[model samples]
Target: MASQAPSRVGKTLIALIKIGLYLFVLALVALVVAVSVAVSQLPSYQELVRRDDLGQMIRVRAADGSVIHSMGPSFGEWLSHDEIPAIMRDAMIAVEDRRFHYHPGVDPIGIARGIWVGWTRDDRVRGVSTIAQQLARNIFLTNDRSMGRKIREGILALALERRFSKEQVLELYLNRVYFGGGAYGIDAASRRFFGHSATELNAGQAAIIAGLVKAPSNYSPTADAEAARARANIVLQLMVREGAISEAQARAANPQQVEFVRTAERHNSARYFTDWVLPQLETLIDETVQPIDVWTTLDVGLQRAADEALNANAPSAQAQGALVSLDRDGAVRALVGGRDYVDSIYNRATQATRQPGSAFKLFVYLAALETGYTPTSTVVDEPVTINGWSPRNDNGRYQGPVSLRAALALSINTVAVRIAQDVGTRTVADMAQRFGITTRVDTNPSMALGTSEVRLIDLTRAYASVAQRGVAVVPYGIRRVTTADGTLLYQHRSDESRVLVAPWVAAQMTDLLQAAVMTGTGRAAQLGRPTAGKTGTTSSNKDGWFVGFSSGLTTGVWYGRDDNRALPGLAGGRAPARAFHQYMARAVANRPVENFEIEVALPDWQVEPDAESWYGAPDDYQLVDPDGNPIQPVEDGPPPPPQPREPGSATTEELNQEWLDHAIGRNRAPQAVPQERRGPPPDRGPPPRRQQQEVMPPLPGQRQSAPPVVRPTETPPPTIRPRAPGTAE
Candidate 1:
C-alpha cells in the first residue's frame, strides 16, 4: 500500500509540470502580440503624404488659425483634425468599418465577412477595408481594384498603422479623400453642396458625403442630382441598420430638394474681365514657368451686374462685348473680357485694336487741357482743309463759338481737330501713350479723331487717370503668392508713375467728364453716386466706348463686332456706358461715396466751338494765342483732290502718284493707292471721309466728270453694318 501511494504522487506531479509548460508558452505569445500592437501605432509614416511647398501655404491667420483661401503651395486644401465634426467621423467609420475602434487598423472579422458576401455573390471578396486601410489605399497605394493590389494595400495599411495612430490616420484620410465634382475632400465638398464649409454641415450633409465615398464619380452632387439623392438614401439605410440613425430621423432627413453644386464646372462668372486679363499675363509671368494663380481684384457683384446689363442691352449682332473696372489705385476690380470664353479666346479687351472714333476725342481734349487749353477755350468748328484735308462735325453741321467743355462733352470732332492743332499732334500722341494707349497710333491728324487703333484695356487704364488724380498707374492683378506649405513665395508690387497730366488738370477734366454724364453723351452711365465719364463713337458707327469713374472705382466699356462690322448707330450712351454704369453701380454700392479732389493748378483759356466754324484747319481759320498770336496748325494733311485728266491729263495711277506725293510725303502712301493707281481715274473712290480729307488732292480746285469704277476687293471689309441711314456715312 505504501508503494502504490508513492506512484500516485509522481503521476500528479508530472501532470502539474505539463500544465505549467503550456502556460509559459502562452504568456510568451501574448507579450509578442502586445509589442507588435504598440509598434504598429507610430506616426512617422506622415512623410508619405508630405509636399515640399507646404510651408508657403501655412499662413496662420493673423486674426485666427483659420486659413483664407488656398494660402499654401498645394492646389487643394487639407482639413485639420479639430475642424472635423464628430458625426462625420462616426459616419465614415460606420460606413467603412464597424470594428474600426476595436481593430488595430485591420479587421480580420470584417474581411471574413466581406469575403463571405463576395463569395456568395461572385467568387470575389469586394471589400471590408477598415478606415485606416482605406486611407492607406488612397494615400499610398494605386487604386487598381484587384486581389494582388488589394493584398499589397493591406500590407501598406498595416505598415501605415504601425507608423501612425488611428486619429492621425483618420485626419489624413479626410484631407486626402476625393469627394468628386472637382472636390478633393470634405471642405471643398461641403462648400460645393451646401455653399458653406464642412464645419457648418448637419447630419444629412455629412451622410451625403459618406455615401459618396463608394462611387464619387457616379453620385457626385453636380453630375446627377437624383442619383446623388439615391446614394444618400442608401447611406441612410445603412446607418439605420447599424443603429447610427433612427427610422423616423432617416425619413425626416430626405435629400429631395437638396441642391448639389458641381464646384468643378467652370463658372464663367467674370467673363469680360477674364477676357481682358489674358494678354496682361505677358508682363506678369512667362508661359513656360510654373502654374501660378492670379488673384484679381474682381468684385463679384459688379461683375454680375455687368453681365446682366450686357445680356439685357446687347445688340442682336452675334452678341459680344466687354466691361472693365479699376479701383482708385488702378487695380482692375472687375473685368468681363468677353461674352464667353469657349466662344473665342480672342480676348477683345486686350487684343482688339479698333478705332475709337469720337471716343478718341477724349484724349485730344485731355491733352489740350494739359497744354495751355481749358474747358472754356474757344475752338473753331467747321469744314476746313489743310493741304487738302477737311474735317466736319459728326452731323456735318457746325455749331459756332462752342466752349471747350461743350465741344468735348458733345464729342464734336472738328473742334477736337482744332485742339490737336493747338497742342502738337506728337504731343497728343505722347500724352495718349502716357495715359496707357499701347495700340498702334496712325500718326495721322485723324488720330485726334481716334482714327488710330486702340485696345480696350489700355484705353480703360488711360481713362483711369482722370479718377486717380492724373497719376498713370499700371493695373495690378495678383496681390501676392504663397508656397504649397503656407510659406511666402512672392508679393506683387506696382511700378506707378505720374503721367504727363497734373492732379488739378485731371480734377477739372473729371468735372468736364462728369458733366458729360450729367447732360451729354454719357448720360446713360449716370449713377446715384458722384461720377464722371466720357462717351466715344467711331466713324461709320463702327465702335462704341464709355469710360467712367467714381471715387472708389473706374470702369470702361466697349462694344463692336470682331469682323469690324457696324452694329446699330447706338451712341456711347447706348450699351457701353450702360454696362460701365451697371458694373460701377454694384462695384461702388457698398463703398463710401467721395469726390475726386481738384488739386491741379487751373490754367485759363478762351471759348471754343459750339459745333460750327472750323478753326485750325489746313487752309481755313487760324489758331490765335491769348494775345492774338497766329499759331500754325499741326496735322497729317490730306492729299490733293483728283483732277479730271485731259482725256488723260494723268492716268489714275499718275493721279495717285501726285496725290500720294503731296498727301503723305513722297516717302509714304496708302496701301489703297496701288489699286486705284492701276485703274482709270474714277469718281466712285471718294467717300465722304475722302471728300473731307481733300488735302493734297492730285489736282484740287478743278472739277471734271468721269466714269464711276468700283474695286470689290478694296472695299473696306464691311466694318460698319450701319443701320441708321444718315449715320452710316
Candidate 2:
C-alpha cells in the first residue's frame, strides 16, 4: 500500500509541472502581441522632435521697448545641445533621472525598485519614467493610467533611444518641460524666475529650476518661495552625490537668497493696459499671424505714475478711480482702468460708460464757439426750464449775467443748457461725436450738463483733439505690430487729420478751458503752467471727472463708486482734479513747457471798467458827493439823451463779487423794508412806476433789459464802445 501511494504522488507532481509550463508560454505570447500593437499605434516621434504644436504667442512691449506682458505659452529661443550650460544639464539629470546616460529606453533596475517599494509600503507607486519615456508620454501619448498607455510610452521611448543621441534626448527634455508662469523650456524659465537668460544661470538657480519638474505649481518660487527653496536644496544635494558639484559648492549655493525678477502683484497694473490693448490687436492685424510682437504706445513710466497718483488720491475704500492719458496725436500713453485691477477687471477707462457730468460741456461750448459765439458772449445763468425739466447750478444761487467763458469755467448748468438751446442740441451731439466721443449722446437739454454716458478714454481723446488745435484725434494704443522675426505685419499710419473745428474756434475754446483751470472750478487741476481743462460733477455726487491738457499731454480722471452709489461730498474739483495734478506733475516733469495757441481776442463787452470811472462814466464825470447827496451839474441838457449800455457790460468788480457771492452762498434776494420807522413814518400817496430804458440789444436767443433804477443825476452819459467785427455781443 505505501509503494502505491508514492507512485500516485509522483504522477500528480508531473501533471502540475506540465500545466505551469503551458501557462508561462501563453503569457509570453500575449505580452509580445501587446508590444507589437502599441508599437504599431505609436505617433511619429519626428513630429514630436520638431515641436510644431505649440500655440501662438503674443508679446506686448512698451514704447521704450520693455516687455510689458506676454500672452500664451512663452518659449525662449531654441538652444543647441552645446549652448546649454553644463551645470544646468547636470542638475536636471541628477534630479530627474540619475541613470539617464546608461538606460536604453527602459530601466529594469529602477522599475524593479519602484515596484518593490510600492508593494512593501502599500501606498501609491512612485514614477520611474526616464527622461526619454517622459518626453514620449508628453509628446505622443495621453496620461491615462491604463496599461495600454504605458505600453505605448515604453515603445516610443525605445524608438527615441535608437534614433537620437543621448545628448539630443536630454536637450529635447529640457526644452519641452514646463516650469510654471506660462514658461516652457529652461531658457524661458530662467528668464521668468531670475530675470536673465539661461546662459547666466548659476548653480542655485539651476537647482531651483530643476526641482520644479516634480510638481511645478507646488514648488513655484513665485507662489511659495520657501517650499521651492527647500526642494532646490534637495536637488543641490543630489548634484553633489552625482559628482556634478563638490560638497563645498552645494553648501555655498544659497537658494534662499535667490531673488525673483518680479512678483505677479508688481506687474498687475500693466495687465490692465495690456488687456485693453490686446483686444485691439486682433482688429489691427491678421488672426493667422502667429507669434506677434505688439509695440504699444504705453509709457511704462507714465503708467506707473498714473498708478501711484490714483492710489494716493482715491477717495475711499469703496470709491474706484480711472485715468486715461493721451498724446496730442491721440496715442494712449497711460490707462488705469480702476483702483485695483485684481479686484475687478471691468476696465472703467475703456469699457465702463458713466455720465461725464459737466465734462460734456466741452462739446456744447465747442459747438457754441463754432456757431459764432465768442468766449465773452453774453449768456443768462438764471434758472432755466426745458420741457418741464429745469437744470440748476451747482450752487443753488445763480449769476444773472455771465460771459460764456465764465459760465463754462464755473460749470453753470443753466448757462450750458441755454447755449445748447441757442445752438441746437443736434449740433452739440454732432460736435461731441466729431470730437471722438464714441458713446451715444442724448440730445435732451440735460445733455449739455453731460447726462449722457461716455467712456473715460473717449472723453480724454475728445479733449486731446482740442489740444491738437482742431485736428481730429483717433485714440490708438498699438504703434506697430511685427512677427517673431521682426517682419512688419502692421504699422500705425495716421491719416491726414481731418479738421473738426476751425483753428480759431479751437483757440477760443482753449482760452475758456484755460480760464477754467486758472481761476474757476478746475483750479485744483492747475499745474502752474498753461493748462486747459474742465471740472465735472454729476447729480448727487455720483461721478466726478477732470479732463485737461498741459505740455501737449491730455489726461482725464474719473472717480466714482462702481455700484453707482453717490460718494458723499465728491466733486470733480476735489479728488479727480488732485489725481490729475499729481499724475501730470510727474508725467510732464521732463517735457518742455508748451503753451496753447490762444489767439482769440476778448470781446469789447468784456472790457474792464476804468477804475477811475464812476457808474461807467467818463473820467471827468461825477455822480454823487461824499455826503451821499447827488451833485447837480451846472448845465445838464436832458441828461445827454440816455446813452445805451452794451450787453454784459457789468463792471468786472461787480461780476467778480457776484461770482464770489454765489460761490460763498451769500446770493440772497434783497429783503423788503417795512414802512414803519423808528419815529414817525412819512406819509406816502403811492409808489412811483419803475422807469425802463433800452440798454442793449437782445442776446442771440433771449432779451436783456437793464434793471430799473434811478439814473445818475446830471452826470455825463456813458459812452458805447463799438463791438468787434465778429463779436457775438
Which numbered prediction scores highest in TM-score against the true structure? Answer: 2
**Candidate 2 on 1-729: residue-level lDDT in tens?**
989998999999988988888888886677566555655665554555445556778899999998888888888867778989998999999998899989987787888888888888985456678898888887777778777777777777877776678988888888888898788899989988998889888999999999998988999887888888999999999999999999999888889888888755743677788988888876887755367789999999999999999989888889999999998778889999988877888899999999888998999888877655667666656754444455677677878768888888888877777677666678889999988888898776667788789999999988988888778888888999998889998889875447777665688899999999998999999998899999888888889999999999999999999899988878999999999999999999899999889874322221332211212235454544334454444463432443457798822222343443454455644232211101111122111211222223232333245232121111222222211111000
Tens-digit lDDT track of model 1 for 1-729: 989998999999998898888888887576456546645643354453452312322221111222323322332445667779876776777677777768876788988988899889987777788777787677556778887877656666666666677777788777667787656578768876777788776767888888788888898877777887888777778778878878997787787856655442244635445444444555654332232444456656565676676666666557578776777676766666677666766667667787776666667777665543455545455543433456666667777657677777777776675566545577778878878888766555566777778888788887777777777767765554443343444556665555446555677688778778888788888888788888877766678888878866777788888877777665677888877776677777788989667435332211211111111224455645444565454455674555666773633333333443443344443453333212111223222222232122111211333112111122321111112111111
Q: Model 2, residue 432: what's the lDDT?
A: 91
The lDDT per prediction is: 0.63, 0.78
Where model 2 places Cα greater than 4 Å from the true spot, the runs are: 1-52, 123-125, 240-249, 254-267, 287-289, 600-729
Residue 322 CA error for candidate 2 (Å)?
A: 0.9
Error of 2 at 311 (Å): 2.4
Could you estimate the TM-score for every candidate? 0.64, 0.75
Please tell me which predicted candidate would have the highest lDDT against the true structure: 2
Instruction: Return the number of clashes found in candidate 2.
Output: 0
